[model samples]
Target: MKSEFQSHEPDEPFLSRVQRVLTDLSPAERRLGEFLLDFPGELGSYDAQELARLCDVSKATVSRFIRRIGFESYDKAKKAVRDERATGSRAFFAHAEPEANAAALALDMREEKDNLDRTFGKLNAGELDDLARAVLSSRKVWIAGQRISFSFAHYLFWQLTKIVPEVVVFPQGGETLGEHVARIQKGDLVIAIMLRRRVAGTKRLLDAILEAGAELALISDESMARHADARWHFHCHTHSDGPQFNHAAVLALCHQIVVRATLQSGREGRERLRAVDAVNEKLLQVEW
Candidate 1:
């Protein structure tokens, strides 16, 4: 006879399956379920024996728990959890352990360093120059982003304005992006910075950019590396030891791009900087 568990949806997510069986679990199973609820990705991080040790249950109990959740084997369930973790969900970092100590701080630093290493290790200088060239030569350059990416896009826009005169950043607050999209021309360039938890309209925005005959540069996390619509894709590593992503690498890349473009701009960049300085001195009464 088919058990009640056999009626699970074919494509149910790993967490959904666990949540479904959570209420019906035995005491030992409930403990394991609650542990997973804290950090579902931990399922992929350990084996049955190790998980049993962490959750204070027997190996056999671990076996039964996974089976009850609709996975054929521990290996299959682990792979599923690992796949889901690529979403960069906050659940992956949720834990009861205190992070105010030195060890956690050390781990955060190590992860940041690793992210920097991985991000720059694959970076090609020639590719950066190509992007910088596009920024310099385009009739107009648009910097686009939403959610956590908005700050990065704004920073890039402000910095690039020092080197290029026709730089624009978009979609501030309640305004629709249609006004900006309508203005894109053939000689324009669009640089989009979209990190994890990107909004649903992301594709539509990219599509509009391309359809308007503008060149596209995409700066996003590694999960978006496979996105082929953009002319250039700069995939930054944002993995972190804590709940939030470390976007230091993304900031560094933006700085690099602006600096390179400014250096390449020669006398033109210098004049633009002088103009901006003149305005700052005249209006703001600031010394720099």
Candidate 2:
């Protein structure tokens, strides 16, 4: 007789399969499940014995968990994870235990340095120049980011506005995001900073921007690299050492883009800075 576990949908992701079996899982199985959910790509990196060791379970338990999730064997489950990753799954797995005290401080610095190195190592100069030129020549530029990503949007907007004409960072106090997105017209450029597990409606907003005839540029982390819909997409490294996601690479990219845009704007940028400075001086906005 054929097994019922074989009835699972072939296209379902490993994480989703684990989630489906969550209620039926034992405490040890659930622990393994949670880890796998967070780090599915790691599944491809370890065998049944290694996975069981990492999860603090017996090899038999790992085999059972694999079967429970509809895989006939542990190896088969591992291969599924590998296949999913090749197809662009959101799995940037850093299998590290949480550090504490002095060790945590060192880990933080090391991870941030790694993030910066990896992000810029893969940076494309041609894409950067094209994006900068698009911003410089755009009739209007709109910037938007949700959750913690809003910081990047605000910083880019703050710097770019000083040198570029008609630059806007949207969803300011008393404004709806939809209202701003709706105003995206032809010849406009929209830069959206969407990081891991992007805010709801982000994809829809990108689609809406495109439908409205605006060019969309996505500035996101690797998790969104394969999924984001945009005319131009830039990925920033966001590996973190602590419990929270880091933003160092994203900020660095923002800084680079701002510098590039300023350079592309040339004399217009200098004049804009001078004009803003004169206004600041006249209005006593800065103390001498």
Candidate 3:
């Protein structure tokens, strides 16, 4: 009720405010607090009455919980949590693990299948072909992937090197991007695979690549909006049944890009493969 509302510290986030007094709550209030902890953004969408119903608490209990959490009013609490979630906090991904069971495994598979469907459902063959042609024509191909994105970038780099002759990635052992961005040339193609929890400087790096007159391919997740500066933007679906992101679609997309680039390469692709094979045979004398 409006009477429950009181002045609260404006700076504390709703999630933290709820957490601070969690230990002191009564059994019923504790239950409500625990529920909200899992879905911090829910406060922004659900009113006191709805929250009370969802938490199975009485209306009076909801009011008690709000004031206990230091919210001046429901509206103030809503704005606080909404703004925090909009900043892309990692707290949203935090959840207790589901038990390892057949049901969980099945859910994972279904989610992965959905990821693939959503990723490829709108792909354009003509657009893919055009992008592949750019890869084949570019003077050099540089890839930038940070955190978990680095693994996918490495995979794409390995595949592209089979036919593209030269492919480069970020330097090993924690080097900075400025050194690499300096190398991008007008005819170069930069494939930047930036996924969620991305580094702060990613957009600036992309901007620099564009300013250098280079072709930019940004393969990303829903967290990043499509930008016109990139020559092509491939948005991969990474949602999952578990806390971690499912990256099956990302691997599939990398494979597709390589396959299309190979087709675009034609004779050059075959010649390059043959040359790589010759070197491997001489050095290792056996294929793994």
The number of the candidate with the highest lDDT is: 1
Which of candidates 1 and 3 is the stronger one according to lDDT?
1
What lDDT would candidate 3 get against the real structure? Answer: 0.81
TM-scores of the models, in the order given: 0.83, 0.67, 0.76
**Whole-model lDDT for model 2 versus the true structure?**
0.81
Tens-digit lDDT string for candidate 1 (118-197): 99999999989999999999999999988899999999998998889898888888878898999998999999999998
Report the number of the highest-TM-score candidate.
1
C-alpha displacement of 149 in model 3, angstroms?
A: 1.7
Model 2 root mean square deviation, Cα atoms:
5.2
TM-score of decoy 1: 0.83
RMSD to truth, every model: 3.3, 5.2, 4.5
Off by over 4 Å in 3: 1-65, 73-90, 93-104, 285-287
Shift in Å, residue 17, candidate 2: 17
lDDT of each: 0.87, 0.81, 0.81
The TM-score of candidate 3 is 0.76
Q: lDDT, candidate 3, residue 171?
A: 48
lDDT of 2 by residue, 86-162 (tens): 54434634443444324545744887888899999988988898999999999999998877778889999999999
lDDT of 3 by residue, 55-106 (tens): 8898788778878777656777778877876555656544333342234466
